[model samples]
Target: MSHEFTVETGLVAFSVGGRAQFGWLDLVTGSFHSEADGQCINDAIVAVEFSSDVVH
Candidate 1:
């Protein structure tokens, strides 16, 4: 199954998989970006955290 979200410029869709597998589409490029076996999202979160770890 698939789910869609309305973005400011266009629509984004995700391909739902069993359990933790999911894929997302890039609205601007019209490309299937990545699929996570439940890890990509968490990895992205970690990356963001690392980038923001420094105190300015």
Candidate 2:
């Protein structure tokens, strides 16, 4: 939404079955999940809030 960017992180989500979902995301791809992909919603939020990148 509004383009995939860190600043737009707050305004992005996937609406599946009419339910809000924060799927896997990447700095490039934004909100989307793939098999063995980026962090989940909880982990992602924590990373951003703490100003830390996931140690992949």
Give, for candidate 1, the lowest lDDT window spanning 10 residues.
42-51
Evaluate candidate 1 by giving its C-alpha RMSD to the native, one decimal.
Answer: 12.9
lDDT (C-alpha) at residue 28 in model 1? 63
The most accurate candidate by lDDT is: 2
**Runs off by more than 4 Å, candidate 2:** 1-9, 21-27, 32-56
Candidate 2 colliding pairs, count: 0
Instruction: Quote the positional error of residue 11 for candidate 2 in Å.
Output: 1.5
Error of 1 at 6 (Å): 8.9
lDDT of 2 by residue, 1-56 (tens): 67654432322443433434434345664544422444454323322222225533
Model 1 misplaced stretches (Cα beyond 4 Å): 1-21, 37-56
lDDT of 1: 0.31
Tens digits of lDDT, candidate 1, 1-56: 39666212211223343232234434564444333331233222111111234444
RMSD score of candidate 2 (Å): 9.9
Q: Work out the TM-score per prediction.
A: 0.25, 0.24
